[model samples]
Target: MEKLYNKYEVYNRWLQDSDGYWQEFIEKTAGYIYWAKKPEKIFEWNPPNPFKWFVGGYTNAGYSAVDYKLGRFGDKTAYIYINPEASVERRITYGELYQLVCRISAALRAFGVKKGDTILVYMPNSIEAVAVLLAAARIGAVSSTVFAGFSPKAVADRIELVEPKIIFTQDYSLRRGRRIALKENIDEALKLSTWRPQAVVVKRALGEEKEPPMERGRDMWLEEFLEMGKHGNCTPEFVESNEPLFVLPTSGTTAKPKPVVHVHGGYQVWIVHGALLVYGLSSDDVIFNTSDIGWIVGQSYIVFAPTIMGTTSILFDGAIDYPKPDLFWEIIEKYKPTLIWTSPTAARMLMRLGVSHARRHDLSSVKRVVTAGEVLNPEVWRWLYEEAFQKNVPVIDHWWQTELGGPAIGYYYALVKDMPVGLEFMEIKPGSAGVPLPGVEVEVVDERGNAVSAGQKGTLVLKRPFPGMTPTLWKDHKRYMAEYWERYEGKLVYYTGDAAYIDDEGYVWFGGRADEVIKIAGHRIGTIEVESALLTHPAVAEAAVVGVPDPIRGEAIAAFVVLKPSWRPTEELRKELIEHVRKTFGPIAVFAGLEFVNMLPKTRSGKIMRRVLKRLWTGEPIGDISTIEDEASVEEIREAISRLKVVKVSE
Candidate 1:
């Protein structure tokens, strides 16, 4: 393993080799993990499901993340919990975190959860909720976490699929100086869901005694739940390598949430290796990944990877804009972390808030910056790197998805490191997502399924399945195959659904999602949800939604709506629709673009061309539309967009 670091070229060769490259690292990294049964085979490749890494291995993700590092790093702060809106701060050590997880694991079994059972964790970004995730993992019970910002309809959609034994939540959450009722939302979700959970474990956010309205038998306080396993002597369940550790919801081709299953063995190995290679994780460093606990970035970077590496991480529990726009900077100054990972949406918002907030704080501790979730525009990148960080550190952008459990492409280390000549890698590219990380093989493919030349734009595809990628969509293998593998004719290549290209020098650049799943402020929003919300409006007859460029949010939900017979489009109507989406989607959807149109442009096949709508809104050239059902419909959209441009200029 040491010898492989001789030349950076050697690592590249391993990636090129692709045969046994990952197995070696997987085996080497497994030595650090606490495995109940060591694997005889490093990997096995079977299509559709695609992989079984560390085959024959029996391990627990929570043990690897917490108990494995307890002896060496127990005294160190594993996480610094801060809720800016609540004005509360606390710290937990690895040993303490391990104890808490043990209690939760026992309570889970008391509540009838077992290996292969699933739980829905719909709580705020608190240490308690994070403990629930680890607790589920400790007992080999799969946990599916939902962003607390989502509405009951969103939660019910996931609940119908998961049919979990327990629904983990809290009394309330604080954000933007408001207390959101989490327990109330859970109750509403239970009403909406067809499948009912056995138990709803509620954490009292106010205090232990300040309880909310609890059901007689179904609801229980987290305190009493922990008391069930108060002995702290619970044994962990060692699930097989392919056993799911957690399920994260991502927007698929339709409105239904696609459960992305990530297993314990490969997931643990990938993040451990990735934390070192990509983010330069070390026991001496503190990392701050600003993604919410619901997202993969937060799960991998903030919780599992950093904790498993025996490093401290800042577990932020509120929005950065809450108390002050400088809340992020304030956290950095107070608790100095060495590495920081956030989304470009957050960076763009901070830029709009002014640099004075950052100037007042100490930022020398952040040696490097990593941004993902969406493409970082060159202007925003330069502003963040030059003006914000003051050119003191490298501002790097990496690329991955909810499907990819870890980063697939990023710099060797965003910070400078001392290594032999062979260990050094390429320089930073402003808009590029760096070179491929150690485990993946990425290529650009033309529509005909041929590999494109360097610098040629085409659909980005993975040549082979990697350890970091999701094993399969949860319970929907057919849809997974059709959506990812069946994109091309019979190549079996993994379609990323992103328009991208590789540079001549081997750097990857993304041109956003080729699919209609638009990302607003780093959260994925299916266009179908936006359209459905619009159609529910009394005055709306039909609607089409697309993502358009937004200075602060990476994209805004641009909706083109056709009105009913008696209802005419008015300024008040537009405002009503905007508020409707925000309320319906529970604050995640920013419906900024509302245009009145007679009809929406659709293809002859009856599919809405969201890309065409996006182009018209962005003023990009409308390419060959011969397949369009009606040319007059497109003309109307063009006129609507022109009026929007005029409104923008006037403002």
Candidate 2:
């Protein structure tokens, strides 16, 4: 592949002359999106805290995503939805989507929803869920979507924070052929919450579960809600660029999850630019994003990015291995998507099924494959490349967080002008998230706020604000500053809370979360490095490492692994895995204990919750397991720990 832009030149310019580079980059990328009002200033930064982007602009994200594409591509398919059972598929066009959004917005207005009011959506990955989000955006209402998997208490916490005026939910959701009563959960949450919001329910699974009794005056069916909108006139509300667009709750190690707020003007600009530059999306492309609408990736890629670019987005409402291990490959053959993005967890899960499942289907239409949400270990990355993709596509690993809103570092195919239309256009670096995107400043720094040299691990920080960066926490500006800004007080930087290192080639290597870094004796080791080493062994399928208190060493490394189906939990295999890591990373990375388990505890977005593992190991109270996909896995780990014998170490 030929180089589009000189990586060194761009990095040097960003380090030395940021203002000039950012100005040019902004001016160039801003032309890609339609802005109702051009901003007088590209960006403005305040001391210690406040930051704004695209000042003095007026735009609505819903309009740019739906209405802007209707004239040119009214009949073009905007979204393709597959039902939970995979028995039915539906295609929706831009014109149809626009009308649905407008009608829903009008209905929300009739139910007392207005500009600046918040609306909560609690539904599965269905067409109604997408419409509710767009409807809220159309009326300038802040949409807060809680993952349908959350418990009543988890949903109630977020509902209390926003106190939304109206809530949208479904009667039931289907998962792996099991029916989940979503309406019952919503009712339980409403009982816990003090505010009584109007509810609109969708009949997702008509016969699976009995319909919960609805409140006489507080609830209505989705069909009746649309009928209410038909009698009223509704129009898209164009607000200031910095108005709140949505509030997404991100889980931490603490008991209370933090709600991150993103706005219209800057978020829209960043999503559109990301779709073009990072994903290389065009009108002819169809993107299959294997994420739920509740997560940040689903909201950005599945809804906002592709819609703004006038491309087709795919939404699958079932597990990847529900019917069979090759269900995802079946989707690729049916939709012929040009791009596929999903979490590393899914890749590892599919790896356990072996390559035969994927080989049964043809994946000729997939041009690019990407993974996020967690570190893409070299083991799974190579398997996906050689076995799943047959070395024909680019397996790109990007890095971002829920707070960042979008990818900050990755291979950008559209970085330079006049590039080819294949995987060769983008460079792939194994085990590294590619260079920073244009106009984004990322640096690895030590605790003293000084930049670190190559191969040295430290905290990753963004030196300047980007268009998509979150302005503040929802109604908690002080906490936002305390968490993100206080660490770099004198310097104007945003702490990313991730530990990483920049290689000599300017690529970023994610170590792990700063809080999850395991320190043994005086040596600091990232759990990801140890976990990745274990994954290299043929027997290990998925692994998670945590630091546990030791009588001699300050802390010792404890590993929990899920083995492939062919391998069984035996003392010999455990010792061999420990030796593998010791040989790969030297004795400093040797595990004090290893337990073979069925699965690792992970969030709904597919991020391994190492904190839960550490808490479970040290006999501490597990804070929140609401976002966990399978709660049974936590108990499996507990039983495995009791059976495994610890490796004694000399002081």
Candidate 3:
């Protein structure tokens, strides 16, 4: 275990020493550029030196992704699109995808969008959405995508922040076998906005005027718009690597959502290097990530990463369990993609559907897979490895955040060739965040400002900047610094808001959030310890552990669990689960109560929104819940809690 990275001691040493860090940074970035594509200028430094990039780059993203492979691999397929209802699919060639992107870039320009202008795109996982994002980059216009499943309020809140002049949306979208009125929601958000965008709506499901437009510049048909730019050429714009390319939003503990800005220069640099290592990507690889372009994973993997590497990317418009539980398997069979990146929540659901769903189709084409967004429970990992893929394919349990643009910690397929069975051998300890990326530095410290030793837990902090880390929260620099930097100011460490520990081997394991740590009788207990123990029960499907205020103990443990189908909760079962926890980690990790539920409140990206639940339990006025992915679940949970009415157990 003696620090797996010590082999590259020279590189790590230079990364820490600031006087020499810039020299090493340039070398690493330059090396990546040369590997990705030999451009006219590898980098350029402008006056004020605010932005740095692949400098005077004479390379087109489209050419790198599509045009370069045209004559040589014109017949190589890029996307294998599957229609959920029809139970059929169509293969799109690399040349064909390139053409669509060019035409769409032309279409966007014909619609009056210009360079440096922002365009709001709200769509699901369709090929057209991917095309539009590339098209925006091709024309130098920034594309701001809103997650299609978000409420109108959520959509409008983002729109109001950026104030884009054009909004791209679809008439309807299909997901999990239901046709959602996407354009209708757009219409509602538009009504609330004082700024009017030239709205272009794709005819996805064949319904018109269901939601009437009340004003001018409100709606234009998708087909008509495409026709307007039919013969136009897509001469890709050469932008500085540090130029702002996309704006993403993250939910705040306070009322509003925080907008995070990422630049094309830094984003491309990291995406190329990170994807290569994380996914073992190659020019011939076909990637299938079941995510929408609205989120970071979709922005990076589904659109940018594969395309930047000049590879094929599969886009699935609906849920993994749409027409059947086998939709993902069906897509893999048809596309033969080499890589599939997704979240564990969906994987767990797929696991519940049983391996029969996978066995029905051919997944032999898949070579590598990744899971992210939230922590992947160890149980899900075992199930995916042994039961689903027959213990053959490697499951990379990636850990990163929206603020950290790419997969900072996970199984590096390129680096770890002989992937280990359990989670530990992949350069990371069981619960640790794993060792920091090549140049990034991580340290765990305590309240009095001192580093904790091995086996002890402390606040997780970043010692240096990586190219992918967000430079600032959009329109809120002070808040951004205060949130991430101020807490450990003089030390130059970025407070991650996460609690973690480093093992003797240098593997980093993440304990839950620092705030989630419960204090009982002068001892601090990580909620993850209790939650993990709770999930060991046969009846428990999933669990969320939180710390609630208590008079005597200062704080106590609360558990919310979603049980297996048809399993009724009883005092007897509850006692059994409590005893199970005691047996696993002793009585110090006891739960206040085991509350049963059908689903946990989560963000659109599958992250549990625990603060909302805390507010609910404490009877705080919930305000502007646009970010809540499951509004109905909040009501259901409240009703269930009222019915239970168990008295608070004291120490």
Candidate 4:
């Protein structure tokens, strides 16, 4: 079961016959779902359009996630909703959820929703929120779910994209026991939007959750909407496989938002494959993902992937460390999930609180841990794999982007057991993303689109199209071409906008964004290298690095570090950290200054916003703070940088 070389040979064959490889998925999917019409062809290679799969075929993505599992997993628990802030746990079966999807889709169609229409889901992590997505995809309508933590303006920015015919939202969202007025935000967002939707459906709270006053004709209560659509047609729409399933906005530090569109056939094909191949999902396993429906992970892993595979997904609705620092462990002891998918930021958050509270609860239930949303630093991976799980489970680190519908590069955790002899001997690199996924051709290329030598840092580009890879941006085909495909002179190569290097063993190591690399003296350094090195230090709980203009070295590294709760920031500790980086990261890493802060700026999806740090360091105006997870972190980091106007270096 460990033939690593044999697996490589299998992967090479898959690359040789890419379309035939996806045909295998088509055959497997056909057994579960009833396709309205069989596809005339398996695929068509054309860019600047949706990734074509099952060309000329008709199927509904939602049907695969819900309908197909009805007979087989009808009474089985499809989802478990756990909200610690509200102190609630609710399990919904396929039959019960099927009814909701029927009623909701009926309601949507009754309220003038139809094929090709777009709707916005501005709600928290709950069964109803995910149901709305399923219902939308069940029909031909496209649904876009926004993060609950986004501001009114941020929501409005996405609202302006499709001018959704209907917005599915909630009365309020509970976060760390704090009430966020979601309905009020939607009302304000509608005013900012130019297109007027026919109706806004609001799902109220549970237990003492009185229905809020509606805006007359503009808003409809969830119960009332369900009643209205009760008699409407609930039959799944016969949508072409290549039709747009949903649109997810890019929430990075970009100057403007580019909503990425995912189609029915290609999206489902890869999400289902990745959930099984990448994460090893099955009906016997329970996956607890600490992500929200606002991002791609939430849509694919939390909602689509598990249900499509007839597995139970633990839907976490509130903060990971909220109510108590040991909330994650409490859930683990209670539910005994087989797999845990989370972010490096969340893991570091728990790691910062120390293990005293975690040790009190049993963590033996987890079989594997997977991390993304930034490179999983070796320090965090080792802690989770060794100290937390006692090295009983593998802490896997995979890489992907929102533009990619599913995982592009990941180790085959689910299929690894069946791998041939040499495969088990393939040692896991704690820091590197395993390898290019099936039928995905990845290479580190220089500026001119030529492959670079192994271990040499360069741009990461996909030489050809993969099923799950985004065909184009939501409505801006020209901009999509300019942003991703045009960077390499419009040669059809997908520019990942990431700086990475593939080792001789074929593992991908992502340093950071291409724009985030720092030039010191005559050497270039990725900020991730400095941050990862800092994380290895005992006192450093979380660290973020950015390059600032330096008179002496062109660019120098400035680090913002958050020490563990037991450790306090001091001049002596700061000097020691500088020396530690000098020794570990080598003297090539020229330090401009190191600032101790209580927190680091991050997006709602848990990605550190290093650009904000660079802006704050130079006394420049930080742009577009809408997606900031914690606003206080920005101000705190800003104040710390004000005292660091004079660069201190060379310990």
Candidate 5:
């Protein structure tokens, strides 16, 4: 439990201080925090407090992200591209990206987008997507980007939320060798919608005007729109620090997704400054962030932090395993990416591919590998460090959430530099999430609003708001208060919903959500969300959701579902349900194969006995089945499992 390394080194630049990291961060905050003032009532959290990062800042994100970099590192490469085919590559300097942002900002304005309006982007990881995002930031227009693989209905559901002024997409896209019809999905989503957006379609597959007419004024090709304006004014639309910059919708406990609104000045500044210390990312490093920009990891690492640092970032369009299992290594070898930031779920999957996949290509350039999305299990962590990085490079386990914009607790190299082998996590316990960043305050508290003693599990709460904390969920101020604020009515703490315990060594170990949420492959899926998804399938009569133990992912979704008459569970049906869930709610939804039952155990009040399911799945002794409406339900499930004998079945 003794301190593994000098913890004070995190706050003070005792290690890796080539750039004066902390001093630069303080200066950055000083310049941006006071740019604009907030009304007293609206400004609940203010600076001088660690939680309130940029209280009265009024600055354009464009200035902080792009222009600031342009001023300092004009010739530094802003973006490095690996074409969809991986046959061609290019790099865009900071100066050139700035110019593109200006022209695109003008193009967006010419297309009728304005300040305070919303723009929906459903596109691939091409330059246009990055350009459009920065363009929206330049104009002070809010942008909501839907993941490219989302189903039509899923896209439509998001479209209906913001009712964006314009929608950006591509005509077609190449993933590996297959051409996916991007415009076709957009057309289907918007075809019968009550609200119509002016679609700014980028024609990725040229020479085919294959899509039908664009309903007159509603749709225009990308070439035509760019032609409308040869140049942009390159002006930064200064927005208040508290104003919303983007709305990122995440899958909710319900079937409908919830949009998490991240503000402009604070969230952007959080990454700009925090990345310097936590990830040790620098202007000299080449980063290949494997996540799409639609997710927070991609938003924070690939787009925001790299741009802020004026470094090169590689964005890919297809599967990490496509073409070959070693594509990630190939990219690193080709690009010489100094930083590898991806999810632990991906790391675990790649670990299953074995060290041979990684050894197939040269990876000498990789100095750091960071994993988010889920807690890095020690087994997987050791594999990544020892097998993949050859125990020379550190694989950092980052602990944060979509709600907490960046790292709240993470393993930073600055503090853990000389720690022993397998002791990379510097702070406290073996499985613990490391201590908070320099200024943030965090605690594990019991129901009475008192801090729980070390090793006692309780609610994980942020005692104060950080610069990266979301001001509110989109149009749900009351819900935000109820979710984060109401637990400690008079206190400023935001309840994280996660359950954790801080050990005597000061490291926090997550005990999972206090509520019923299942994390499959590091993605948060509300048990209720998966239950609803199951109900949507035609054969499902009744369903109960629970999280089952997994070695790699923290937990996997397991459902005890009953079927309609004559609809027996077959391999075909299981595959159908899996695909149905995927189509309805993306890949995160399809966590496990459906376990069919003749009946589901429930209380007299119609509540399903999820606890019983959990117990059964974990092979624990069941308590009381007297309350079950049909006591035979458990027996039937056990018998079915016995017949199948699929203890270690992969799928």
Candidate 6:
């Protein structure tokens, strides 16, 4: 069949008739996979709440992602694993990966895992971790992963929610040459929770110091777990389209994290379609997704997306700048990936190391660089294009949330039937998150559910549900309806809770979170706008802005900034930064308070925890911070706030 639609046609159709466009898109992408039973309908939507896709289809995500590619590309490399030091490298071909996934699936089934069962994976990015997730999908079981660095309480809380049949983890994770005890954290978490699930431990570091003792009946070694599966025959379980595939917990900064659920057929379709259209991947390409498997990006791209496309994916289990600032560049030099997807915070962190480190390696193999976790500041975007990638590659910044499950608004690297060979990525706007993807319908609407005019900021909402969008929060359909659907009462819209505006050219621009927008003197300002303006200054490396209570203005803008290598924190520099914001964005952008700190508190995925900063300033109780990268960074901000108080008293 001829390619269904090109980039321009798809966008125009989406704008003209979104419902028709999405139905056709879903039908077209379905041809790429093998289905045990076809769907009865493309989608079914209740009046103002429930939405589902691929209503009656039956498919196995693991079979489609791993086993289906074996006949055509069995010998093709599936995964390329690299260590932090670039010393050890391993590659797993499609056929080999299939066997491993089968063994793991058999093991899970042997341990009494059945369809509809939930399994919790708490490990770093490794072959075992990926196999465990696919194994769960192979058996029609739901899997959820918590970041390896999460605290015992964080893990226990998630475990309490899902109550998985088995929990998979590794003995330890190596970060920056330091060994983090993963199994110990799991043990601690098990103690806190009342549920007793079987623990499957992968000995990643055997004979390195003393290994933790496994409990008699509760814990089993990975090898032994696989051995039990060797005696049993394992086959992929083709499940209904809407069957729960995985439950991913949201990384909300302030509120308790909720589990967002995605299904088999819809999620598989979206991953294959989105990876091809957004990241521009083919079976011949290699992808290096610099995200841990715990985050949504990692769950989608690092594991299922690339593998489903039968492409080589690089799984790096290390820090970006460990041992040397050029670690990422060095990996690129070794692996020569065509597409590199990472977080914006990583880009800023690399920017702080200067371009000299990146220049030392030959990055000619890289065609495109994409970032998504948070908004990409214009300064960092420019630096990435000009300095790091040398103005040759396109730096694509896309936008999506954990709830959406995939890219909702971004450039699509569409290749129509007429032009199938060679790479053809969409145009890249410097700061905007590009246009909506082929099947997604995005709109900026006012409080009354009316579409806002172009260039007017409003709440970002999805007019129609796409295949990749999460069905609902796990076991909490009411919360899902209230949080997303009920907000725009009487209208079937998915409120994103993000303040955004569409430009005259049809590109979507994000203006921070709606709740995070600061209202001062009857004027509303986006925290991202102020943070972006501050980043334009030469000495500033990173900045996080928040709103603090103000008697006169109701809420005032407060900024926390991290300086460049040579610049030191001083009252003069702070004043100059405040003045710089005023000059760049007018008086409204001037911060009521600005503090220079060594580092901003961030999640493991590199998102700045602005809520933590706000709470520290206002003396509010800071909630669970187990996912924070550095607890000391919060202390640094606290000390800066203390100094501000001392200055206030002196004044």
- Quote each prediction's TM-score: 0.94, 0.79, 0.73, 0.79, 0.86, 0.79
Q: Write the per-residue lDDT of candidate 3 for residues 59-164, one digit (tens) a residue.
A: 3343445555566567777766666764545667877888888888888787777777888889877777777777887777877888787667567878887888
| lDDT value, candidate 5, whole model | 0.71
Per residue, candidate 1 scores C-alpha lDDT tens digits across 319-354 of 887788788998899899888889999998888998
For model 4, how does the per-residue alpha-carbon lDDT over 585-644 read when each residue is reduced to its tens digit? 344567788989988999999899987998888777897889999999998988888777
Q: Which stretches of candidate 4 lie over 4 Å from their true place?
A: 1-7, 29-34, 46-51, 198-213, 252-254, 416-425, 487-490, 515-651
In candidate 6, what residue range of length 10 has the lowest lDDT sum?
Answer: 1-10
The Cα local distance difference test for each model comes to 0.81, 0.78, 0.67, 0.79, 0.71, 0.79
Q: Model 5 TM-score?
A: 0.86
Model 1 earns a TM-score of 0.94
Best by lDDT: 1
Clashing pairs in 1: 7-422, 8-422, 8-423
lDDT of 2 at 456: 93
Which segments of candidate 2 are over 4 A away from where they belong?
A: 1-5, 8-32, 84-86, 415-426, 487-489, 516-651
Better of 2 and 3 by TM-score: 2
* Cα lDDT of model 5 by residue, 564-650, tens digit: 996877877877876776766565564443577788778878877776777777788877777888787778766654543363223
Task: List runs of model 5 lying over 4 Å from the truth.
Answer: 1-43, 46-53, 84-86, 176-178, 206-215, 231-234, 415-430, 445-451, 488-492, 511-514, 549-556, 565-572, 601-612, 620-651
Count clashing residue pairs in model 5: 4
Give me the displacement of residue 65 in model 2, in angstroms: 0.5
In terms of lDDT, the poorest run of 10 residues in model 1 is 414-423
